[model samples]
Target: MSNIKEDQANFTNGFYLETHKRWEKFSNWIHCICVVTFDLELGQALESIYPPHVTLTKQETLNICYLAFPDSNSGCMGDTNFIVRLQSCPSKAVLSNVHTAYNSKCPPALQINPAYYWGYVYFRQVKDIKLPRGYFQKSVVILSRLPFNNLFTKIISVIAPEYFDNGNLSLEAACYNIDQWPTPVPGLTLSLPLLGSVFQTFIPHQRNSTSLILQLAGLNEVATSSENQIQASVEDLNLFDIFQPVLSHIDMLWELVITAEPLIVMASSPNHCSLMVLALTRIISPLKFCADHRTYFTIHDSDFKQFTNKVHGTPPVILGVTNPFFAKTLHHWPHTVRLGEDYGQYQKYKLKKNGNSKIFDSTPGVYSSYKPFLQKDKTMIKNLISGINTKRPFEVQSALLKKHLLELTHSFMIPLERYIASLMPLLKNISPFRAAPTPLPFNPDDFFAMLETAGPQLTTGIKGDWVGLYKKFFRSPNFNGWFNNRYTELALKLQALQLQALSDADLKLWVQGKPEVEIVDMVLKIKNKIKKCEQHDIPVSHTIKEQLEQRLQDIISSLPDDLKNILQTS
Candidate 1:
């Protein structure tokens, strides 16, 4: 029995060692294939297989090999130009026959166990091929997989929320690939997410959030710069005075995802490694600290939380009136208080003053002089008056008022913060609101209507003004004056239309008066204008037309129920 137990132990140990050895061999094989393959097939195949104990069928293995070593795009494999030549007594016919047989038997794709495969293949056409050993070696390193096992898999599951519940197939395959190449490649960082990691995690979702964050950060940076410039220019001509409607452009990125959950999942996934890196870089970047104080201070969540805490603790108290005698005493005392004499003098003075006051009238004239003596202090006065009028303690009234004021302030702040945050990305497109030459409230609808009526005449007028200004100041050529004027005029007009469409009253009125019918008529008019413009070879901008169409849509969206019903009819 003892001998049998010992044998059993020996057998188990040997089996474990052999398994390890097999995995090592497989890793080597995969590395070699990666080096030899010209295409992404092998890597993709490895990615498709689940990890750990993953075993590909014979067919699957062949398919993987074929994909890895595609004959097309020889440049990817190596820069060596080579020609194939058959030597020996074998007839051309015989060589052709052999080649055909080899090709027929070869699988469309090839797969090999990353752990056990160690063989290498050399591609030789009938000619001399010049291959770089270093390049081949680098490719091999890239293709090799990292060592992953059950233990590693468990660790990954715990660390990466996306992969926790998934099966071990992907992990096993990744481990096998890792075993193929034990050494890391130069210039290749380990931080890159493996293909398996991408599959298991929602990377795509995180990408969107990261993009938005980056965009916001960029806008904030621009706004900060502009604000700084404005501050610096304050001593000079009011920065706002010389400001013009700078033509600004904003790039709006739109993605149509079916659901929000997937977006959230992607944002939360491990695949957002790039986003994490970006966030870290931004946090550590020295330039971020140099930004405007408000912007720099606002970016941090902790600072806002601290401010809120401080404001919450201290409540604002109002100052008011109490007793006439005490008030007089408080007012007359020359920075010092005397007890009996001063107090009596103060009372007499208060009685004379109280004769004319309504508050003293409430009490009998004789006792009015004996009015309650309360020390005159802003807070004390406020408290006494509030208590007398409200019939409540000063502290309670102040606390309640402070709480209400804070709430109102907070209500205003939340939306402002959100808007400011949103504006960060759009800062580049928004011209600074100038205070010096008070900015004219540019009505978009009115502007567009004028443009439609005036066309190039209005554009020319703007250009003439700019040209006159340019000649007066710099005496320099204004080559772009005409183009800039035309574009600006058109843009302002379109802006006006967009603003009008956003008006709730106009939308409601339009909808009630048969918006659908109006829309159809408008579409027809636009189509005809577009056709005529094309026919006449007129340089009408399509962008203006598109904006007009969008305004129609906005109007439709904002239509009231009664108007909507009218539109629905017929």
Candidate 2:
């Protein structure tokens, strides 16, 4: 045991020592440059409030940016800067197509008032290091290790000169309960929800390759096909209850790289602020010109403005708070701009429930939903229940708890089961139209594996929990029927179209004399064949293998003499 303890201690110290060395090797001022590009009007409205400093052509709409990093456990000294601009976007083609799809009246030229913002953030703890070569720009600020104060403030006033005067910066915090309701803090507390409502807010965009590839494809419908939009409906949010009211304290230091115009007012408690940073980080991590995910679910700056101005009667400049904190107060921001409202005034629309007023855009693509079984469980319901008080008589408490558990089961679990059941048919139909010539058969076991992977997220309740409940339903006599049934065929034709589009685009690239593209095409084709056989639990026939090899040889023979010689030699 002593040897084991010594080994563990040695390993811990070694890990920290290595991590510190890596940090030292990196540039003192580590910059996470994310360029967020969005086409939707909601994205535009969010950007409208920023003071303009750059002009872009009509095709460009908005560039929402984060100027600096939060002082937290997030490895680097600082991160997270927010900025938005109208015009001059990298994804002009995608935005143009989206504009045409959504608005028919607009000309090929997307005319909008030119607007921009010059934002910068200097990290306090990064002062010892000098700026690296080629890092100068009006928008860029050198991060330093010195704390943000009047002295550093004086220095920035001369250097950056843009955000020298913005001072409406204030920190505010809100509370929430087990049900994600904003209950009063320190009382009326409950265990955190099994599925973290804020988990989506931490999904980094760059990490999701599907979104990035689709964004590059410049197809609006195809790129955003995974998204689901719905009308926002207000619910009774417990506005005061908060779980783990005390935030995970981050001992790092940072200065809010802010603007002086006072166009926006931000409020958030420490935890709330962390969630906000996390949400922003998740959404804009790489900030490639992809369509925003969670159009229905993730709350933005515009949402807070609408809630405060219309619902809560605390209308001010603008509000930038975390989704979890702000969600308890308002459902969504108004999509329509009033006649006389300027960018700032435009943010404060009347909070009337017009059914169409609010848009809930859900972000996660289909691939983002499931996790392997071995991952950490976010809900921790069983553990929480184990820690619960059982002072009452066993029979009475058990009976009451069981009834309440049933209610919860009926509310969330049943609907989830039904939703998953409905999707199985879609999954099954997809096999027929799969781009691959040899489509892999849909496996019930694979679906079951997905469930196992997502066990932690789906698991809920203090008693049987989500996994046990799902198993119970899975064992039901009619479950097979339910899982195999086709509910809606709207998405039936869509899968074929998606597959065709991908094939057409890839073929086009191959025809353009891109040997690499052609090689990739063949590789994918062969890979799919192998995958299909493996998934279906079948062996690949010799004839099938021979044909694939011949195709590869044909592709190689067709290569240019110089390339063919190089390939042969390699």
Candidate 3:
């Protein structure tokens, strides 16, 4: 049977109203999310089949990811992206987009043709948590579950579907971030790895549409991000602020794809790579970690799992209490106990302080239980979590990840540069006088006419971005002079052949032996060329005509003195 479950987040049984109201209380605006990706690598064999765009940066792909469950649909999920600078244009310096899945159906318009700002998104296969459907039935909680395979397929399909096809999706989540926090603390945190997908759909602006298309074409692999941890705490203790960092970990996912057929053709036409950078931002999950000590931590599913294990040994003694004293004693005491809700679950308990115990109302909202660990262990765990969550200490972890990403980017560029260097020789040795399969009678007028029609195509071969490549090649200090020299040699040879053929045809020598049928075929081909030129906005062919004639005259003058004098006399 298919494991796919109907998305519960889509309001079906009036459940959406309940969940929406819950998050509404904590909702904060003005969210800022950033994605930085570098060190992009393409398959060596694939590069030969479909060459990478040389006009843009190579190390420009990376992944970002986050976790999700019952409460949040567009919650913090992991995402992957590539960061690059435009070659010629200024102003917009970067391009960033995040990929994520949602339980609710998108708008009808967005499903087929998503808005330009929506970035790129695809439908993710989903399933229900079979047991959890009953577990939280007594309470207002609902936990949704979907397998990693479904998530992985959706992610890779958005990127280059042809290469990463049928990839195995494997992911594991631990109760705690082993690297940062080895032991269990009073608070909860989760560590999970997320799959990265490509964002291919982009708005059709002249600047970004072309470069983005080419960049995504060569992109095959989906980026898998490093494990990110989300920490949640509910401590009323003032001493906690001194020990822990301000934030535990910020999980953000960004996915974007560039798609525009017409723009791709236009931007890549000229010698200059129509290079422009674009930066766009969308709020995946906007959560502001409280900078003050009064802030309470909220745990997600991943973190709750770890918290469950730490208290698994100790049974919770459920008690009904309305007084602050009951909760205070529970806080001061040890052993896992639940006052109202279960421990290690995504429940935020309100800590209200009051001095009078006689007026203490016996309500189940306050939890009391025996402590699980020794006093020393408890202190250590609390201090470690606190220190990591602090602003300065958390930044250290973020910085380390950033540095690692940059190193990967540098490594990717080395092989890419080598590949481009290898192509220099082939580009230089292009033969201008190479004969076609069918040789037609030589006519200078026809040659010039074809040149006028195929102005850009004559220099740019099929499947090659020659003009963009040439501009980029000239900027390279190592190959600039050599490329110019080889290009000059090829241009001059082609010009000479055209001029010589024209001179011979005028003198009635070049086609003297050719039959009348051959001449007619050449005339037909020339007419078709002219027709094609009229179809589009033709560049100034007259300018090229003048240059061709001037070059022909210069070549004749440079000829040997005896030949030149004979030609002049004739």
Which of the numbered candidates is closest to the native, going by highest lDDT? Answer: 2
lDDT of 2 by residue, 56-111 (tens): 33322222222232212322332223222212234322322222222222111111
Each prediction's total of clashing residue pairs, residues at least 3 apart in sequence or on different chains, is: 49, 51, 41
C-alpha positional error of residue 87 in candidate 3 after TM-score superposition, expressed in Å: 30
The TM-score leader among the candidates is 2
Ranking of all predicted structures according to TM-score, beginning with the best and ending with the worst: 2, 3, 1
Candidates in order have lDDT scores of 0.26, 0.27, 0.23
What C-alpha lDDT, on a 0 to 100 scale, does residue 329 get in candidate 1? Answer: 23
Which stretches in model 1 have alpha-carbon errors above 4 Å?
1-55, 69-74, 77-570
User: Model 1: per-residue lDDT, tens digit, 249-353?
Assistant: 000000001000000000111112112212211221111111111100111122234322333441111011122332232222111111121111112111222
> What tens-digit string does per-residue lDDT give for candidate 3 at 1-570?
011112121213333345433222111100111111111242111111001111212311111111101113222122211111111112213221211111112211111111111111111213326543222110000011111112222332332222223211110000001112211111112222222211221111122222222222222222333233211111111112211111111010010100000000001111011111110111010110001100011122122232224344311211112223333333322211122312222232332232233134333222222111111223333444444556344334333333322232223223323333333333223332232112122333443344344433433222233233323323433133233433443444443444333323332232346564554444333333334334321222654445444433444454457755654454
> Model 2 misses residue 555 by how many Å?
13
TM-scores of all candidate predictions against the true structure? 0.16, 0.24, 0.19
